[model samples]
Target: MKKLLIILLVLTGTTAIKAQTRTADESAIEKTWARFGNSWRNQNFSDMKDYMTPDCHWINVVGMHWRNLKEVQFAHQAFITAFLKDAKAVDKSSNLRFLTNDVAIMYRVTHIGAFYPPDGIDHGTNKQGDKDNIATIVFVRQNGKWLIASGHNSDVVAQAAASDPVLHMNK
Candidate 1:
């Protein structure tokens, strides 16, 4: 019985060490996201590049896909120029877990306060409200640092009932 107890204690100690190590990884990834959000709100998008991989991919809430860093930059720049007059972003992450020693997946709900234009540009958007959305990002650890590899975003949609014609339309 004493031998069994010793073995169990050793196993528990090993598990504790792993959990503590992964918590550090989680903190690092979370800090990366914090930097990204700060850059976004400040309209200092150039700073965000450092947190993303060279080949990072992003899917915006509007279903537009950015396949590369340059594409993502262009998209964000356009949005910042045209729509984002003044805004701030707050994100809460949950279910953040490491998929492997070098990868993590987390669900984030981002609440953005976006000031809208009087008339939206070519995309035909006029109505604007507080934009809140859920997003998932995969962070990959490379060279002992975390960087965003890919992200998918889905807006928290609000509309009328299905029976209403307005339901199918963007408000």
Candidate 2:
């Protein structure tokens, strides 16, 4: 009878240890999402794929969509070229949660440095373009690493501010 009691206690202890370990792994996955946000803002695509699955899907409010890692990387490169042309990059990430051991979600906010057009072009040339926005990343754990399986972005457009500058410039 005593032996049976000892065995039960050992089982309970082992289960608790596993639960704690799983929690830690989940937290690490969330941190990976945060790191991805930082890398994207800095235009470090080289390491970006490490956080995403090869088959990840991405989309933005402009209707731009990417289905594979290659496309996703290229899309990001385009964004970096169009904007942040000599500007500092900054980002904030948070709101990470796991729906299951293999699935998670997080949000990020990025700020692009001051933008200026070519020497002859006006600074307000692209004022009508999109600005600061929010991105939601969904991750899935496969094998041993957490990968971003899907992403969605909702761009922030300061319609009032944008229209005013453009209209005033034409005046």
Top-TM-score candidate index: 1
Model 2: lDDT of residue 156: 58
| Per-residue lDDT over 1-171 for candidate 2, one digit per residue giving the tens place of the 0 to 100 score | 999999999999999998897788767776777676576567667776788789989996567899999988777766656654455545654577778867878776656445553332346564422356677888898888888888997755566556766767755
| lDDT (Cα, 0-100) at 125 in candidate 1 | 62
Rate residue 105 of model 1 by lDDT.
Answer: 89
Name model 1 segments beyond 4 Å from true: 1-6, 117-125, 158-171
- What count of clashes does model 2 give? 0
- 52-157 in candidate 1: lDDT tens per residue? 8889999987788998888877777677656764656677546797788999988998777655654234355654547777888989998888999999888766
Task: Please give the RMSD of candidate 1 to the true structure.
Answer: 6.0
For each candidate in turn, the TM-score is 0.79, 0.66
As a whole number from 0 to 100, the lDDT of residue 17 in candidate 1 is 97
- List pairs with backbone clashes in candidate 1: none
lDDT for model 1, please: 0.79
The deviation in Å at residue 25 for candidate 1 is 1.2
- Per lDDT, the best of the predicted structures is 1
